[model samples]
Target: MSDTALGKDRRFPFGLTIATLIAFAILIGLGAWQIKRLAWKQDLLARIEVLKTAPAQPLATALANAQGRDLTWTRVSVDCAPAQPATLPLVYGIRDGDIVWRATALCRATVGGYGAVLLDLGVVKALTGQSAPAPVALAAPARAVGVLMAPRQLGGDREATVQKFAAERPAPYILMVETATPVPPGVTPAPLPAEISNRHLEYALTWFGLAVTLLFIYAAMLWRKMRS
Candidate 1:
C-alpha cells in the first residue's frame, strides 16, 4: 500500500462529531446569553444613576409617572399628614459593615391623589417589644422628602397580605423617608445607595471562558482521536 493509503480512507466518527457540535452550540448560546445580560445590566445601572440625581419630583407627579411601572427608587417629596406609626415587622439596615435591624412604620398619606399612600417612616435603632420603634408623633401635617419604594412583598401569601393591610389602600408604592423637614425625632433617614453594583460583566466573562475551555477540550479530543 502507498504511504498515503492510511491517510486516505479514515472516516470521521460521525456520532462524536455530532455530539461535539451540539455541546459547542449549547455553550456558545449560554455565552451569548451572558453577553446580552451584561448589556442589559449596564443600561439598568445607568438608568438608576440618572433617577438618583434628577431633582426630587412632587409626590403627585411622581405617582403619575410611576403608575403601572417599576418606581422603586424614584425620589419624591410631599407635605404629608402626620405619620402614624405601627410596629409590624423589623426592616434591616446596614451600618459600619454590619447588618442592623431598624423599626419600620407605615405613613398614610392625607393629601390629594396620593392619599392612602403608606410612607415608611425612616428606621431607628430603638424598638419597643414589637421589633418596631415607638410610634412617630408628627404634627398634623408634615413635609417629607424621600425616595419612593415598594413595600416588601411576602412570598406566596396574597390572601394574607390583603388581610394584613386591610385598612390601608397602600399606594402602589411606599416612601423611604430621606429627610423630614423638621426631622422626625429619633428617626434616621434611610439613605439610598447612589449606585448599585453591576456584576454582569464578571458573570459574562465566566460563562464565555467556560465556553472557550469546552471548545479547546473538544478540539484536543478530536485531534487525539484522528492521530491515533
Candidate 2:
C-alpha cells in the first residue's frame, strides 16, 4: 500500500476530518449570520421604543413624513368613517391567551393624502367550531387615535375580504385603534403589544457557543486518533 493510504488508515481519519471541517464551517457561518441578525433586531426595537411614545401626528402628516421611511408603530390621528359593517373581515389572532378574531375594516379617511385606510377595530372572541360573532357597528366619523402598523399576512379567506377594499386604495399601514369616539360594540381595541421580545442576542450567543463546542469535539477526536 502507498504511504499516504497507510497513514490515513492507521494514523489519521482523512474522510472524518474533511467531514468535520465542513460541519465546522457551517456552524461558524450560522453563528456569524446570527450576529448580524442580533444587530438588526436591536435597531428595530430601539426605533419602535422612540416612535410609540412620541406625540401622535395627523395621519396625513405622518404619511407624508414617513416617505421612504418605516412608519410602523407611529401614533397617528385620523377622522375615519367605517365602511359597511356587513362587508368587514375578521382576522384570526390570539389575545390574552385566548383565541380571538381581529375585526378589520376599510375606513374612508377625511385626509387627502390617502383615499382610505385600514382599521383594526378590535377583537371578537369565539371558540373553535363556533360561528363568528355578529359584526359590530362602528359609530360614524370617529376620531381614531391609534398607532400605525404594517399589515400582517392573512389566510386566504380573510385576504380575499381585505382585497375587496383594495379598489379604495387604502393606506398600506393599518391603524390599530387605541381609542375612538363612540366605540364599536362588543369589540376591544387591541393596540401594539405591550412588550416586544428582543432575544436575538441570546440566540446569537447560543449559535456561537455551539460552534465552539463543535471545535472542541473535533479537537478531542483528533487527540484520540493521535494517541491511538
Q: Report residue 58 deviation for candidate 2 (angstroms).
A: 1.0
lDDT of 1: 0.61
* Candidate 2 lDDT, 156-223, residue by residue in tens: 35445546777887787778888876677666787766466777667777877887888889889888
What is model 1's C-alpha RMSD? 5.6
lDDT of 2: 0.71
TM-score of each: 0.69, 0.81
Highest-scoring model, TM-score: 2
Mind giving the per-residue lDDT tens digits that candidate 1 earns over 146-227? 7766555312332343346657655656666677767656665665643456676677677678778877887797787678
Per-prediction backbone clash count: 0, 0
Candidate 2 has a TM-score of 0.81
Superposition error at 125 for model 1 (Å): 4.0
lDDT: which candidate is best?
Answer: 2
Clashing pairs in 2: none
Candidate 2 regions exceeding 4 Å error are 1-8, 82-84, 110-113, 125-141, 152-162
lDDT of each: 0.61, 0.71
Error of 2 at 38 (Å): 2.8
Could you list the CA RMSD of all candidates, in the order they appear? 5.6, 3.5
